[model samples]
Target: MSSYSNDNTTMETTTTREDRLGYNNNTLKIVVGAFITSVAWICLLFTLIVFFAIFKSGQLKKDTINMLATLYCWTTAIYEDSYT
Candidate 1:
């Protein structure tokens, strides 16, 4: 809890000595992890869409495309393995 007091000269802010509830290190870590995961998923989806468009347009080199696909597979595999 907090309160603000004012006098003719200045204003003072005060809070309770008790600790705040419902938030801690684990909560912070979970929130950060969720945010990162969401951003990563969005980026991954965007990249895939762009890749598909480029593939269809036949502008990408076959070797580089294959390497990218392989890297994506490895990344997915690692993420799944780590999470599960």
Candidate 2:
């Protein structure tokens, strides 16, 4: 009976260790995912701001290519924001 009790205790200890390791792995994944998402958002915002500056400068007001590029940038920003 004493041997059986010792075996049970050992099993419980092993299970606890496995659970703790799993929790740590999950936390690491969450942190990495958040970091990637933040970087993506920052890039998107930067692109939007750059294009906005160009659009507002009025130097390219009569340029068709500049207008198209500005429109594309705004559309992309709106589309990406919608998914979030």
Candidate 3:
């Protein structure tokens, strides 16, 4: 009984040591999952930034158009007075 118990202990210790020495399947899976999630988050952030940039560009165009119209109206009024 003592010898049998000793053999079991030795086998357990050896298996534990071997398994602890390197990356296991579970560890690899976790690492891959983390990397993929990080990439996805980065892509999401990039998409949000692009959306914000496009929105700001559109607002700037609208402001520019409004300014040009105002300038055109003032210039037309001035020319009309000068002609009269």
Indicate which candidate wins on lDDT: 1
Off by over 4 Å in 2: 1-23, 59-84
Each candidate: RMSD to true structure?
A: 9.8, 7.0, 22.6
Q: Summing lDDT over every window of 10 consecutive residues in candidate 2, give the lowest-scoring window.
A: 1-10
TM-score quality measure for candidate 3 = 0.49
Alpha-carbon shift of residue 50 in model 3 (angstroms): 0.1
Residue 34 displacement (Å), model 3: 0.8
lDDT of 2 by residue, 1-84 (tens): 112356456322234565756675667767766766676566667767766687688655657456656766765665555445
lDDT per residue (tens digit) for residues 1-84 in model 3: 123356456422244554768756677667766666565556556555655675677754766556545655554554344323
| TM-score, one value per model | 0.52, 0.48, 0.49
Q: What's the lDDT for all of these models? A: 0.65, 0.61, 0.56
User: Model 1, 22: alpha-carbon shift in Å?
Assistant: 1.5
Clashing pairs in 3: none
Candidate achieving higher lDDT, 2 or 3: 2
- Look at candidate 3 and tell me the lDDT of residue 18: 41
State which candidate, 1 or 2, has the greater TM-score.
Answer: 1
